[model samples]
Target: MDNSETHNQRIATMTFTSVYPLYLKKVEKKGRTKEELDQVIAWLTNFDEQKLQELIEENATFEKFFQQASLNPNAHLITGVICGYRVEDIENPLTQQVRYLDKLVDELAKGRKMEKILRGT
Candidate 1:
């Protein structure tokens, strides 16, 4: 299988709760707030704070979390490289969505303004 397919399978089984704290640390170390992270996540996944917490608490896998997500209509606007992969260039739809989330968290950590990170929301 291609790298995207391999990657998809790997990440699909990774728990959201396991990855969430890393995202939080990445942003916080850059002086960004959790609220900013939440806003970007909410923009992409349409999960409110309470719902997001529930998913984390449930130890949802990336696949399960995204399957339940109401992806924002503007998610295509998120285009960038994350962990050396271009988010827009990912072949698998599910992997692309996951990368989109990664890109958003990356931008948040890099101190991007929230409005722009939300694609001008």
Candidate 2:
């Protein structure tokens, strides 16, 4: 009932981190294949806060996310060729997305805790 508790609770349910769950719902409706889902998971392993925001700001359709997933370094083996066009400059949303994703993947590679916090983990 205190301000600190309320702030902590709000942070716990952050929408930014919820993007993965939202993507999960769309995966089935979008008719994604297992291979594609694998690509998605691989890309998610690379997800970081900055990249998630950039993707959203670009009004990046699921297709754009999928395209970027294909190029993700960690997911590249599964994604095969990198089809998405690259943008130079961190100011560019796409570039920022890629940068964050790369950082995220690096963190995961080190076996760091993936979730900042889960509802019931």
RMSD vs true structure, all candidates: 1.6, 16.2
Worst 10 residues of 2 by lDDT: 78-87
lDDT (Cα) of model 1: 0.89
- Against the true structure, whose lDDT is highest? 1
Cα error of candidate 1 at position 3, Å: 1.8
Q: What would the TM-scores of all predictions be?
A: 0.94, 0.27
Off by over 4 Å in 1: 1-4
> On residues 18-92, what C-alpha lDDT tens digit does candidate 1 reach at each position?
999999999999999888888888999999999999999999999999999999999999997787877888888
Q: List the residue pairs that clash in candidate 2.
A: none
Decoy 2 TM-score against native = 0.27
Report the C-alpha lDDT of model 2 over 13-70, residue by residue, as the tens digit.
3433345444444454555433343343455444454665676676654436645554
- Give all candidates' CA lDDT scores: 0.89, 0.41
List ranges where model 2 is wrong by over 4 Å: 1-63, 66-89, 117-121
